[model samples]
Target: METAIKVENLCKSYGSINAVSNVNISVDRGKVYGLLGANGAGKTTTIECILGTKNFDSGTVLILGMNPQKERKVLFERVGVQFQESHYQEKITVAELCNVTQSLYKNPLDYTELLKQFGLFDKLKSPVNELSGGQKQRMFIVLALIPNPEVVFLDELTTGLDSRARRDVWKCLSNLKAKGLTILLTSHFMDEVEALCDKICILKKGTPIFYGTVGEAISCSPFEKFEDAYLWYTDEEGSENESV
Candidate 1:
């Protein structure tokens, strides 16, 4: 498959602490790639640098064969992003929010279609603050899809969602993958990563512990459980150092 995004020796830091260190990874076109890591392991920092939202101390980053730093606007046109948190003004109606996002794109997805897909068509008149947690999450995802981007970045997409809502998000993502959108997702949920990613990258302490197919990674372990394999790969053999 052709490459959609590439990073070489990427590094990011805050003050004296390094967030991402010498990280090299690549995402292929029309594939779903998962970035799995423990909290504060630099997954978010790496993505921020790749998307040109944060500057890296060193290394090169490219998206769609264009340098993100040099072609930020052009790159953004083809990329959709859903942040780790959902934050909207309390008074903004769902429809109004969607309409405003649609205006930012030269060619946006039909707002009504998106609302229907997210099951928010009936909640269009409700203010964002009035929606339940699941409904709010659905709204955020609809916003992400409105741009109809070639590449989508979902940061901790299922965090804090109830099981039912999480499953809904997964279904929506599967549909997006079927449509051939390149996806780069960061999640702590091992099962979620395995269920959705075609390929996976495991990060620990600002570095890649492993990068390969989930099946291959699992096969490397003597244990039958994929979660056990993950634990082994991360060097958590009944060690106290292991923490999610």
Candidate 2:
């Protein structure tokens, strides 16, 4: 498959602390790539560098063959980002928010259709603050997808959601993948990663402990469940002191 995003020798530091060190990742077009790690494991830092929101100490980063730093304007047009936490005006209605976001992109998706796809069609006029956690997350996803982006970066997409809502979001993401959108996602939930990701990368302390298919990652561990494998790979005693 064609590469959608690539990171080589990616390193970022804060003072003497290395946030990400010699990290490398490749995301293929039309695939969901999961970035899994514990808190403070450098997953967010890695993504910020890839998105050009944060400068790195040294490394090469590419999105669809364009340098994120050099082609930021062009890159922003083709890629969507849903941060781990996002806030909107308390009284802003869902429809109103969509209209504003739609205006920013030249090739925006149909707001009505997108809302329906996310099961937020009936909540179009509801204020953002009034929506449930799951609904808000869905709305945020809709906002990201409104630009009709080729690649999307989602951080903790289903965090704080109940199990039923999380499953619903998973189904929505699976549909997006089926429609050929490349997605890069970060999450603490291993089950979510297993359900949505075609490929997986497990990060520990600014280093990649595993990078390959989800099945391959599972096989590398002694456990049968993906969650168990994840814990083992990130465990201090179990993790090797080497990057993948």
Candidate 3:
């Protein structure tokens, strides 16, 4: 399979603190790659470096055969990103926002069809601020897809959503995967990763402790559940120290 994103020996620091150290990742085309980690584990830093939103102290990053740093303008046109926290003007309605966003892209998806598929057609005229948490998230997904990007990046996608809403968003994402879109996502929710990700990278203190399929990760750990497996991987030392 062709590689969609690659990072080699990526390093970044904050004065004395190393945010990302010698991190490496490879995302294949037409697959969903999950970046999983506890708080302060450098997941965000690694992603920012790959997207060229932040400068790494040392390393190389390539996105779709082009250097993101040098070809950002061209790269961005083919990539879609939804940050952990996205805020739109409170006064703008869903339809209006879609219209504005579509204007920015050369070849955009049908705004109406996208909204309908996400079950947001009825709320098209509703103000962004008035929408519920789930509605807001669905709207964000629509915006990300409007550009018809080949690679989509979603950070903490289901952060504030309820169980039902989270599942709804999962279905939407699964649909995208079915269409053979390459997706890179970061999330604290292990279940979300287990459900959506074809390949997983588990980060610990800026280092990848585990990189493989979800089943492989779980089988390697003593725990049966993904959450416990993740906790074990990230907190093994802490757990050992506490036991001692």
Q: How far is candidate 1 from the true structure (C-alpha RMSD, Å)?
A: 2.7
* Candidate 3 residue lDDT tens string, 26-77: 8888899999998889988888888888989998998898998899888888
Task: Give the alpha carbon lDDT tens digit for every residue of 172-213 in model 1.
Answer: 889888988999999878888888998988887788888899
Give candidate 1 regions above 4 Å deviation.
235-244
Whole-model lDDT values for every prediction: 0.85, 0.89, 0.87
Q: Give the TM-score of candidate 2.
A: 0.93
Question: For candidate 3, what is the TM-score?
Answer: 0.92
Q: How big is the positional error of residue 236 in model 2, measured in Å on the Cα after superposition?
A: 3.0
- Which regions of candidate 2 deviate over 4 angstroms? 237-244
**Candidate 3 — what's its lDDT?**
0.87
On TM-score, the leading prediction is 2
Please report how far candidate 2 places residue 227 from its true position, in Å.
Answer: 0.8
Worst 10 residues of 3 by lDDT: 81-90
